[model samples]
Target: MDKLRTVSDTKRNFYQYHNRPINSIYRRVVEELMVEMHLLSVNVDFRSDPIYYLGVCQSFTQFMNGYTPESDKDSIFRALCQSIDNNPDEYRGKAETMLNFASQKSPQELINWLLSPTDDNGLQDVANHWRYALENPKFKYSRLFAIGLYSFLAKSDAEIVKNEEKFAELITPLTDKLSLPIDKFKKDLELYRSNIEKMTQMLTVLADTLEASKKKRQNN
Candidate 1:
């Protein structure tokens, strides 16, 4: 938080994450950040509060990013599909960045980015990547980022609706993919009425276990 103290609102509001296909979701997240923090992000041009992050900042790097005209994109798409099917987590971000970027663009901008000439042997997976995201655990469990991912998914006719079975299926596979023990995610979501309630429950369990151990040690 201290890092925030030295900065002006303009800089913070205008902070751009320009590394495309890597920080693809940055534009949307930054936009949301500006909206959420709008009370502090003020401007005087119209004597009204500045709407920060209302738009994505697409750079002039269009021609240099993707595959050349002659390169075959077949193998990358196959690999992405296989990796996602065998285990979704392992391929979490393989094609998500451009999907996020394309999703957030306006129609004209979208057309421009799509039609831009390829720089070199661009991975054809660019065409199939979002389709992969549509089929993975990332599509279901990544609700927090669905808005960012949704831009692509929406265009692809993908759905990320709230569903209980999907939620359950998503958490378990995702937990294993990340090598997280299933019990941990379950434990984190527990709610108690108060801190004291949680403390009491923990103390009671700890005391009973400790007492049983004391008896065992004494008997031994």
Candidate 2:
């Protein structure tokens, strides 16, 4: 039997990935948003609400980085329809409404909508409407929606990075994967480390210069 996991379990697992800077920051942002939403009386279920879940993912990605593949629009519409068909009781009206909205727009219009600035109230209104379709009340804060959007994304990205690290560990006969002998791999690693050291020194110099500027301004 498949064991059921709680939201706490999911959170704990995802927290392990926070060493990946982007995902870590994103998770913190999501956690803070969740707290704020609770304060505002918005009942968001990261575990159970599919609309809220996927809606969060969609809008959060846009908010963090306002770019969507041009290729995904049609496929997204199709998937919505399929989900609705599979569970008419839950998704029928919402799916149809989304389809209608999509049908009224040109492909470019849809792309523009996705690319719209996160700060734009109009863009948020559209995201809120999607959440409304799932029977949740309109979100008072736009940031809450972003938390929903990024909750899954942050974890997924972290898992990918973890898997990549694991793959590197399992690549035995490392020469086969690197297409170089072990000695060559060591040589390349040393060169890379030296380059990194040079970059670190440059950054240290920049930091010192900025600190000196701050002190000089204080004296003046």
Top-TM-score candidate index: 2
Which lDDT values do the candidates have, in the order given? Answer: 0.32, 0.37
Instruction: Provide the lDDT at 204 for model 2.
Output: 69
Query: What's the C-alpha lDDT at position 28 in model 1?
Result: 40
Residue pairs of candidate 2 with colliding backbone atoms: 56-148, 56-149, 57-149
TM-score of 2: 0.24
Q: Looking at model 1, report the run of 10 residues with the lowest lDDT sum.
A: 46-55
TM-score of 1: 0.22
> For candidate 1, lDDT tens digit of each residue in 1-220?
2323222442232332112222332234334433323322221121110001111111101111232221322232222223212222223333344545545644334333333422223424443443343334332221122222223333433342134344345334434443434443333222211332554565568679989999999999
Q: Which residue runs of candidate 2 sit more than 4 Å off their true CA positions?
A: 1-8, 17-19, 23-27, 33-50, 66-220
